[model samples]
Target chain A: MNGPIIDITDLSKFYGKARGIEHINLEIGEGEIFGFIGPNGAGKSTTIRILMNMIFPTGGSARIMGMDVIRDTKKIKTQVGYIPSDASAYSSMDVHEFLSYCIRFYQIQNGEQRISDLSELFELDLNRQIADLSLGNRKKVSIVQSLLHNPKLLILDEPTTGLDPLMQSVFFDLLRSENKNGMTIFFSSHILSEVQMLCKRVAIIKEGKIIQLEDIDNMRKKQLKKVSVELADHVNIKSFSIHGIENVITGPGNMLSFMYSGNINDLVGFLSGKEIINLMIEEPSLDEIFLHYYRS
Target chain B: MNKNLFLKEIRRNSVSLMIWMIVITLLIVVTMSFYRTFLENQSKIVGMLSLIPKGALQFKGISNFNDLMSVLGFYAANNVIYMMVLGSIFSIVLSSNILLKEEYDKTAEYLLTRPVTRSEIFISKLAVLSINVFILNLVTALAGFICMELVMKTPFSIGAFLILSIYTLLLNILFGAIGLFLSTLIKRAKPITTFSIGLVLIFYFIYTLSKITEGAAKMGYLSPFRFASVDATNPAYTIDLWHLAYFIGISLFLTGLSYRLYKRKDIYT
Candidate 1:
């Protein structure tokens, strides 16, 4: 409460010789929806697993609400909710039974009401067995269980894999309302659009390291740009080589496309002398930005 | 131990427990039902048994032809494999899967993320495992007792019967501990039911092999079954203090080791 809601300092996890996450430091303040974006196997789940104490860190420490994630895991979990990337629940149990079982872990008033409310919001069939539900429905069940406790911190790992667009919108609105009610969230996903839509601040991890950490708006407002040029005469990709240019590729018929993060003036001056049939420069989508980070 | 987890586990395993109880009880009853015919044709059966290889008979725990003269002896020789070996298979299978099922089922995310420590979860499941093993032993022992009472022409030694029952219980519990310890040693989430059952059978094979092979008698020490005295007709048959210590010591050691390993285990799903 006094400092950050979640504080991870130089946290590292290694599965023997294989790298998981290395020297990762992060601080998420209270009431913030913090996004952790990475491609598959980039250590998003590894970091979350360590924070949840489902797996141990090879070195360093992670704390939630100023309590050690390892030593104080039980206490930390009391106030934290987690939605795993995989939406596997007890298939033998119906939706109501599984949700009820989960809610009993926390000491809360009107747990039944909470279950009902959340179930209604997700349009989950209370009588449906988990195995009988579709993938999207199973995801809805996962989301409902995580919120039953009204935890101060909610840690979600790829929380929206199978939800429809409508459900995703409803889920996001619910998350906004919860954030307004003073819950800090750690949302991990490979999807950049969702992160861009919801998170205020984000950390971009690549190859087991945090490559970039910045405010969502600041990240977009940065000098990063998607540039494409069509030349009447064929231009060698070597000529387009400049600092901050990544993922350069030559398209059909004398066309070149790449991400350019260098100064705008320098990019324009470099292109001014070229016989340009057409030139296009615009802000890159978050996916493109993420690709740029990964390429860099 | 968390009461919620313990209760939930108990409820989850109740059906399996009941099925095991029924199967073992049926096994004991059906085996004991043949006692009357065995007694009636004693001389002819002895001649027939003598024609069979001595090592094969010993493998069935028949040390002597006279050991099957008494009803309880007949039960012990015929039913030890079912009650002890099969019961052990049941115990280990239950214990091994009780904790590991959550991992393979991918429900550990819900469990580990709850407001409970790994210690509490492990202890709770251990409690369920112990209770399950105890109930299986109690039910099967009672069924054996009833069958002996109903079928015996001569009364058997109740003391010897009780001692055999306790040995069976101890053996089953030791297997449960072994299963728990095995589950913790696994780095990934996968069902080891087949492997756990194989371990029990392999141990039984070792015990039987040692019994039949004169030169391999010393190898019985390696099998928990060797420590379980099942010869109910032996006048001096009692629960050996050394054997009791071996069962209790090994069980406690494995259980403690399992608990420690699980506490630090990186549970994956």
Candidate 2:
């Protein structure tokens, strides 16, 4: 309540000789949509699992709302909502039964009303058996269950995996509304675009370590771009070297490609004298950004 | 223990408990039904039984032919396999899966994420295991009682019958503890059903082998079944203090150890 809503310090987890997350530290403020992005096996889920206390960290500490994640797990969980990466629930239980069971874990009044409201929003049939539901429907049931208690903090791990694009829109809208109501969100995913679309601040993880932590605006305004030009005449590759030019490479024929993180006008002015036959400038993929960070 | 988790686990295990109860009760009833035929041809049956090896008779837990003549002895010898071995199997299987199933089924993420501690989860599932084992034993013991009453030519000692039933219950509970301990030690989430059931059978086999082989009689001490006295016809038969301590002590030790291990276990799903 006083400092960050979630604070992780020098946290590390190891499974025998394999690394889970190593000496990682993070802080998420209240009422903020925080994104944790990483590729598969990059320890995104490992960090989240430690925060949720689903697994113990081999070292370091984590706290939620100023309480220890391990020692005060029950107290912390009362106000924390989590949607796991997997949409697996008890297959033997019907959707309504599973939702009801989950709601009883808290002392919330009007539990049925909340379940119905969330289920309706997700277009979930409460009576359908979980085993009978498609993967998408099961994910819907999972989403509805996480929101039934109206938690103060919501932690999602690849929460939109099986949902259709339309459903994903609804889910994101609901998340935005929840955040507006002062609920903090920790959204973890491999999809950078989705993280870009929702998160205010983000931490990019790779090889079990945090590689970058920055405001989403700063990340976007860093001025990284993919530029490719096919010259009408063969030009010296050395001439393409400008202030922001990086990873410059020559292709078949007279094509020159590189990444630019400098002023746009400077790149245009430099390329003007080259007699370019074709030019393409687009946003770099997340992988390229990640590679750049790793290389640098 | 959390009430919500306790109630849900009870509901989840009710069907399996009912099926086990029915199967054991039916086995007891069918076995007890043969009592009248055995009584009618007592001499011929005794002579035929005499021709069987002494070791084989001891394996069936028949110390003497006269023990078989008594209805309670007949039931105890025959039904130990059902109520002790099978019931222990059921108890171990139920206990082993109650917590681990949440992991293997991938529902632990949902359950463990709730406002409940790992201790509460372990205690809740243990409560369900204890209650289920109790209910199964009570139901089948009652069925055994009824079958014995219907077939008994003479009144048997009530105290001896009760002691026998307690032994069976203790044996079942010990297996339940073993299962819980085994489950906690598993680093990965997978059903130990076959391994749990096999442990019970292997213990029973040890008990049987110990009974028949003179040189191996001491080996039965390694099995929990050896501590459970099934001789229902002994006039002084009562619950043994050491056996009671063995069952209660080992169960509590295992259950406590499991709770500690589970509290710190890195549940992976």
Candidate 3:
């Protein structure tokens, strides 16, 4: 409570010679909705697992609420709720049975009411067997279980894999409401839009390393966009040459497409006198952004 | 041990344990039902058994035809193999899967993330394995006792019968420990049921081979089955101290090793 809600210092995990994560340092303040974004197999789960004490780190250390993740895992888990990437529950158990099992782990008053409230919010049938639930429904169950105890810090790894758009909206809204009530969240996903929607700050991991860490607004404010221009007539590359234009490609119909990373106004001013049939500026996809980061 | 986890595990495994108990107790009853017939046709049966190779008879744990003269000997000869092999299979399969099944079922995320330490989880599961093994032994052995009482032409020594029951229980527990050790040694979360059953058979094969072949008598020492003496008809029969030490020592060593390995195991689901 006195410091960062979660602190990971120079953390590293190696599976023998293969890398899991290396010297990955992070600090998340209290009441923060922090995002950990990376492509699949990019050590996002590795870092979260270490924090949850599901696995140990090969080097360095991690702590939550000023207690070591390994040594104080039992105590830390009493206040931390985690939803794993895969929505695999005890399939033999019905929703009510499984949820009851999970809630029993925590000492709380009115646990049955808490289970019912969350299940209704997710539209989960209490009597439906987990094995019979759809992927989306199972994801809903996974989500509800993590919130049953109202943990102070929630760790979600790819929490929205199978939910429909409507349920996703409900889930995100619930997350926002939870954050408003001072529950710090560590949300991990490969989807840029979702991370960008809810997270205040994010750390982008690439190939088992923290490649980029910045505020979500700062990330967007970096102004990296795909610029595609179709000229009325053919123009030499020198005609529209400007700072921040990269990977320029000339195509049929005089289309010039490239990535732009600098001021949009400067580019607009430079294009004012040019005869252009169409000019487009769009946000790049997460992979494209990663490529840009790698190239930069 | 965490009582919540222990109780949950017990409930989860109850059906399988119940099935094992029923099957084994039934086997004992069915086999013991023939004790009166074996006595009624003793002369004719002796002639037929004499023609059969001694080693073939010994493989079923019958050291001599005369061993079957007593009711306890008949039980040891006819019914011990069912509990020995099937009970071992049950013990091993249960132990091997008790911890790793969470990983195989991809429910380790739920179990490992709980507000419980690894030690508590390990010990709780181990307790379940032990209790299941004990329950199976108690129920089947009690069934054998009742069946013997019903069919006995003359009363047999309860003391020797108790000793035989203890040996069988010890052997089953040793298999359970072996299974736990094997599960922990596995680097992946795949079911090792076939491998576990095969190990029990292989050990039985070694014990039988040592008994049947004069040259391979020393090979029996390599099998835990050799240490479980089944000669209930012999007046001098008792639980050997060295054999007891071997079973307890290996079981304790394997259980300890499993606990240590599981605490630091890099679980992947």
- Please compute DockQ, using alpha carbons, for every candidate against the native two-chain complex: 0.84, 0.86, 0.78
* Proportion of true contacts reproduced by candidate 2: 0.92
> In model 2, which regions exceed 4 Å deviation?
A226-235, A251-257, A263-286
Cα shift from native, residue A51, model 1 (Å): 0.8
Can you tell me the CAPRI class of model 2?
Answer: high
Candidate 2 yields a Cα-based lDDT of 0.91
| Ranking of candidates on TM-score, top first | 3, 2, 1
Candidate 2 per-residue lDDT over residues B177-215, each given as its tens digit: 999999989999999999999999899899888887898
For DockQ, candidate 1 versus 2, the one ahead is 2
Instruction: Rank by DockQ, highest first.
Output: 2, 1, 3
DockQ result, candidate 1: 0.84
lDDT of 2 by residue, A1-296 (tens): 68999999999999999999999999999999999998899999999999999899999999999999999999999999999999999998999999999999999999999998898899999999999999899999989888989999999999999999999999999999999999999999988889999999999999899999999998777668999999999888777777978899999999988998888998898887768899999878878888877876
Q: Candidate 1, residues A1-296: lDDT per residue as tens digits?
A: 69999999999999999999999999999999999998899899999999999999999999899999989999999999999999999998899999988988889999999999999999999999999999999999999999999999999999999999999999999999999999998999988779989999999998899999989988655568889999899777887777878888889999999888877888888888888999999877756777776666
Candidate 3 chain A, which ten residues in sequence have the lowest lDDT sum? Answer: A238-247
Residue B167 C-alpha lDDT in model 1? 91
Q: Tens digits of per-residue lDDT for model 1 on B1-269?
A: 99988988998999999999999999898999999998989999999999977876776657799888888889888886679998999999998999999999999999999999999999999999999999999989999999999998888899988898999999999999999999999999999999999999999888888887888889988999989987677788787899999999999999999999999999999
Root-mean-square deviation of candidate 2: 1.9
